[model samples]
Target: MDESVRFDPKSPLFVNDPHGMLSILRERHPVLWGGEARALSGRVFSVWHLFSYADVGAALKDARLMREIRHVLTDEELGRAVPIPEEFQTLVNSQRNMMLFRDPPDHTRLRTLVNKAFTPRMVERLASHIQDIATDLLEPWPAGQRFDLVQEFAFPLPVIVIAELLGVPKADRDRIKSWSRIFTQVLDVEVSLETLVRGNQMTKDFRDYFRDLIAERRRNPQQDLISNLIQVTDDDGGQLSLEELLDMGILLLVAGHETTRNLIANAAWIMCRMPGLADALRRQPDLVPGAIEEVLRLEPPVMLTSRFLAEDLSIQGTAMKRGDEVSLWLAAANRDPAVFAEPDAFRPDRSPNRHLAFGQGIHYCLGAPLARQEGAIALKTLLTRYPRLTLAEADLTWTASTTFRSLTALEVETSAAPQ
Candidate 1:
């Protein structure tokens, strides 16, 4: 048996068949030692794999779990480890504008400001806009010709919606996607120098663009998220600094759209595979809310979240000192039979679904309400518009990242007439 078989980074089994592999790992060794895996950049990463429901949950909610590891690698190791170049770091730092990367008061303040922009009322209001965006994007589809649903509809719609929310320029939407794709490559364990460089440059360009956008908004304020955030004043009349503003803007642009793109693609791919479930959605549109939750449980957009232990804690009967990285596999936990009944089946009408697709406790996804709204709307629209929607081919490729799961592309045939 291949040693990497259980946790092989290169095996299709790990990539295409994570659930199955995870099942085996749980049965044999719930908390398995991954030892070290060589990165594409040739750096070795020592990871501790946690696979059970209770274990993963405890790690996520545990106060002892920290997010940053300092001095884990020796000075020599630091030299060998893939160093994010200074230029790349500078650009990446420019993007470190928002709550996703920060801790404590900063994270809390930024999240509060962002939340005000994405309130339930705000999300409901955006429904018409979302519908219009989806309609416009799909309306031009040539009926008889096959199209990649992901690239054409799933990908662009979220980008446009998020751009509108963030006050990003209409003309720069496509370029935002390009930069986002590059900047997002750091999520992979095997980070590439080229992607790091590209991601850095992308952030720099975005910062330059947003600084100008901020100045414009200050000069001539509008009704977008940027303007809303800029004008946010506390009882003491304090506002965000220039650096905070730029960071928050860049974070919203990149992380905001990236997660939803995956959610939309993953949900659609799952539905297409299960004909009955897809049919149920077509017949009962109201069931979309439940269905979205179920799909999020089965295949969450952000599959894994890691916490660097700030203090000593025990998980799955294992003791950990401060600074250990605890990875919470959301996808694995969502399907854990221990928590959810018949975890693998796609039940559209699942009741009391407590899946942690948006995570749990303090760090729950800030855009949870918005993401659900967009996903439910998109899925319902796609199914309603094309009841006969079917995959053009079944062999779709998965993106090469352990932390995130999404189809690289999914070509489909729809019932609509050729435009």
Candidate 2:
């Protein structure tokens, strides 16, 4: 590893403009070995970053590159040899059970059940409702006035949609959002111990809340996902255990909205910078889906994901030992010149577009269809309603997390209020 190529993933500069740094890495060290970085729980660990289009795409589906953390580190290596702190143990256990962090049979089983609830028909069914939600959210913002797109629009839109899907009461949306935000901290590559502790508490709170909901659903079924999941049986006529249910619920609630929120906000941010782009989409609403794909390629919500080597392997001539952590830089892969023409340019009409935004292989994002629908609806509706929408400020604030490319807030103004 070249000492000059080392960069902190969590640094403000890197978080704000990762592509700039990533470009250098792709050019010189496509599969650079990035050394120790602190995880959310303040644990330091090493990682190898795959930056090239070829490397990332192959690694995403590479069976040897596994998702389960336990595959990489043994119980003793993870400090589980000694008595673990209760809060830390809760947090660790929660992550271990999450479908995102699991592999093989466990992942396949959980995903199969989830697929039943989050089907294409179900997503298509919500299209009109999603449009209505977007319309309602945009209707209140007066013309020629400014509002935070994240707070007033992007954040609430998906939160409400996912909450409704889960059968969570409207009154409890705020609480759900709070817990989701806390839980998201642990997803970042860098986080404080304090944040981890709070996240553990939120996990417990979420578990208790959903436990009651699950019980209620059993006694009285509803048309929502929670109820459907409760009744969903496996091939053996088995059901998700209580812990599985809670973990899956948390995963759905958090993953369901966070990425969509970022996608919507990122689309708005990009349109604000490019004049007439929004109008072009408004004139041709059919182009919105392609535009969303472009945004996913340019500003992927989740920038990077980790995989551990299941066995010794030589990737692009670099030898990697078994159990070594490999960070697949999806954002960087999307911008690789070898695969994309003018990869940095935001060309909405770019065809043969195969971006790794939703990932590749069996572990690809399950909420991808719903996210696309929500993003297209939200962006098209906003552009149609606020024709002259523009960024309120030249400089914007972004979340200081390497794993997620997100704006803390996006302020915009319209020439005239919607009728």
lDDT of each: 0.74, 0.87
TM-score of each: 0.89, 0.95
lDDT of 1 by residue, 1-419 (tens): 12454466446667776888777776666776666545324545546667777887777676566443332334454345566568678665564445665566566676666666556776778999999998898877745557899999888988899899887888988888887777667656567778878777777787798889999999999888899888886545667788888877777766668788888888888776776788877778889988888878888877778766566656666666554455677777888888888989888777778887788766788778888989998998888777666789978788878767778898988765322
| lDDT tens digits, residue span 1-419, model 2 | 56677667877888888999898888889988787655434445657989998999899888889997567666655553445578667777888898999998888999898888667888888999999889888788866779999999999999899999889998999999999999888878766889989988998899999999999999999989899888898788888888998899999889977889999999999988885787788788889999999999999999999898887788888887766789999999999999999999988899989999999988899999999999999998888777778889888988988889999999898775322
Mark the 10 consecutive residues where model 2 has the least summed lDDT: 37-46
Candidate 2: which stretches are off by over 4 Å? 37-45, 73-80, 417-419
Clashes of each: 7, 2
Which residue pairs in model 2 clash with each other? 143-416, 143-417
Model 2 Cα displacement at 252 (Å)? 0.6
Clashing pairs in 1: 66-308, 66-309, 66-310, 67-308, 97-247, 97-248, 143-418
